[model samples]
Target: MLNDTVSPDFFRKDAAFDELYPEHIRELSQMHWTPIDIARKASDFLAVPNARVLDIGSGVGKFCITAGFYHPETAFYGIEQRGELFSFAEIAKEEVNLSNVAFIHGNLTELRFDDYDHFYFYNPFYENIEPDSRIDYTIRTSFGLYDHYSRLIYQMLDEKPSDTRLVTFHGPDKQVPPSYRLVNNSSYSRVLKMWIKE
Candidate 1:
């Protein structure tokens, strides 16, 4: 059980935070989930007071839960295509007791871009192109689906108003539109990048 205060100690390390989930879910942490530190850095750039941040292909809510826990004033929403992952995300959010985090069980294409003020993506569409990196066999993945999803997200981001924020972790740079300028990036690695629409 977690402590009542939910101190920062609980999030000090990825292994410590992975304890919130079951054993199998914990196993996927190294691959499918975002590290706590990366989540924090991404949230720092995306979180604006009262802003709604959406995590595309949020796999077990790791990004959303971490962001919501750190930034209570911001609402973090995650849309996951897998039902099982969505259930686990909801459970994790409940366990963490974060009111600002929400997990939606649906595809990214179904979401309305206008509903969110910012976005975070961790190469969600890569699984469609790389079979070895697939989270599971439950969802159909193909090169065609990857192209379609990538195109859709590009269009969505392109349609958003100026000043919309975006963070991409290990995602393809081509997916981001020219209108959104790269504002900053993690010095540790180029895998994490922050962008703002001009």
Candidate 2:
């Protein structure tokens, strides 16, 4: 059984946090889940007080849970298309006891962009283009879906009001609209970028 009283330092390492999920889910961490440190840094940039941050494809709720744990004032929401992943996210959220985090099981295109104030994306569409990166077989993957989702996100980000924050980890820069200016990023890599709409 897992510990009920999660420590304050639980955020220190990925293994400590990954304990929330089962072995199979934990195995996917190296590729799928956001590294604990990256999630912390990205959340720091995006979690303006009372902001609603949406993780475009919140796989098993790792990022959302981490962000919500660190930024208690900000609410984090993740939309996942896979029911299996969504179920795990909900279970993990309960174990963590974070009221500020939520999980939605639905397609990204079905959501209203206006519902969220900020965005976090981890190349959710990559699996569509890269055959080996898919999380599961529930969602159809194709170059066409990649193009469609990319175009849809580009246009959506383009329409957001000024100062809308966005953080993308290992994401395609082209998916971001020219209106969203890259402001800050890690010194080691451009893989993680922080952006704001002008």
- Candidate 2 on 26-125: residue-level lDDT in tens? 9999999999899988998999998999999999999999888888889999999999999999999998887889999999999998999999999999
The RMSD of every model to the true structure, in order and in angstroms, is: 2.6, 3.2
TM-score of each: 0.95, 0.94
Task: Name the candidate that leads on TM-score.
Answer: 1
State in Å the error of residue 60, model 2.
0.5
Q: What tens-digit string does per-residue lDDT give for candidate 1 at 24-55?
A: 88999998899999999999899898999999
Candidate 1 Cα lDDT to native? 0.89
lDDT against the true structure, per candidate, is 0.89, 0.90
Single out the weakest 10-residue window by summed lDDT for candidate 2.
Answer: 1-10
- Candidate 1 off by > 4 Å: 1-5
